[model samples]
Target: MTAITNKGSGPIIQEIAAVIVENKAYLSEIDGKIGDGDHGVNMAKGFGRASDRISAEDTLTDAMQTLSDVLMAEIGGSMGPLYGMMFSDMADHLEDTDQIDAAVFGAMLRAGLEGVQEIGSASVGDKTLLDTFVPALEAYDSALAGGADFAAALDAMKAAAATGRDSTIDMVAKIGRSARLGERSRGVLDAGATSCCMILTGFADGIKTRLT
Candidate 1:
């Protein structure tokens, strides 16, 4: 089985943060279509702060914990709390592991999904982040169960995340502020789904690069 050492994986979190920060304007623009336009600004702020605090030698779990803390305590948007809990749960699941293999990663992904579901009432088709998150997790686990290697599973996950994110474009908002817009929300992509795809894809790419 291929695995990546947790000890030197902190830079992956930094790279994820960079991806968020780089796409700040784009994310907010998506949100501006039907909801508050601060999704990108808030996400970038929280991720940027966490990235600055994470060290090159820090473990992936440690870096994620820092990110969770920053998002939960400093950010003021709904996404902050949701993503904070998700990362917190994911880090907790991986806290004791030295090597991140397919099984371990699947458990971590499940934990994160559970965390998001616990605090939020939205379901898979609600046009929230779960649209992207749920399918990505399913694809990753499905790939692993089908005998794919870690890198291959990550590829499956990344593809699913993108597909799920795009799927949101045709979904009417069933929750959040956008729900008020009803049919008007159908033409635009959900901002949460977009960011979720970026995060999952970033994770997949990072893990694939570190797999050994």
Candidate 2:
């Protein structure tokens, strides 16, 4: 029966931004192995800016919209548009919700994934963020379906996200600049998947903290 109010949950997005900002170097390091090394720098810049725009008066939807706007318009790279659409879709799904329960949260996650798939060509095993994202959402949905509570479902999601991120390490890149590396890319983590894990876990932790 526990849920988190949309109101005052803007800080959850802020927390996500903070985590991205703090991990900028690590993300870039991973990216540098197979692609451009600017993943962290760009992600940190956009997320930090979004954090500044987030206000206490903003609801969860409002905060997500602000972040979506920044990522779509300001950041450069394929990630910008992909993540922009993801957040935009999530915010749209949650726009009228006063409380986020497991079902609502699942809808939001599915919406985000749909939005990303609409604009992205990557799929599971492509050595992209979808590797982490697809499994995380599925795990969350399965947990809810199996009679787990909201917090427990979130735990499932976070754990699945991490596992998915780790899975990317052995995968050969099938898209993006990394694809050119072929077998060379197999030993390193996909930067996008790593970042996706961070974002999903941040969301899980933030929502768990706000459960009422």
Provide C-alpha RMSD values for all models, in order. 0.8, 0.7
Specify the poorest-scoring 10-residue window by lDDT in model 2.
Answer: 1-10
| Candidate 1: stretches off by over 4 Å | none
lDDT of 2 by residue, 52-163 (tens): 9999878999999999999999996988999999999999999979999889999999999999999999989999999999999999999999999999999999999999
Which TM-score value belongs to model 2?
Answer: 0.98
- Candidates in order, TM-scores: namely 0.98, 0.98
- Give per-residue lDDT, candidate 1, residue 128: 96
**Which residue pairs collide, candidate 2?**
none
Query: lDDT of model 1 at residue 177?
Result: 97
Candidate 2, lDDT over the whole model: 0.94
Separately for all candidates shown, the number of backbone clashes (residues 3 or more apart, or on different chains) is 0, 0
Q: All models: lDDT?
A: 0.94, 0.94
**What would the TM-score be for candidate 1 when compared with the true structure?**
0.98
lDDT tens digits by residue: candidate 1, 102-211: 89988999999999999889998989999999999999999989999998999999999999999999999999999999999998899999999999989998998888
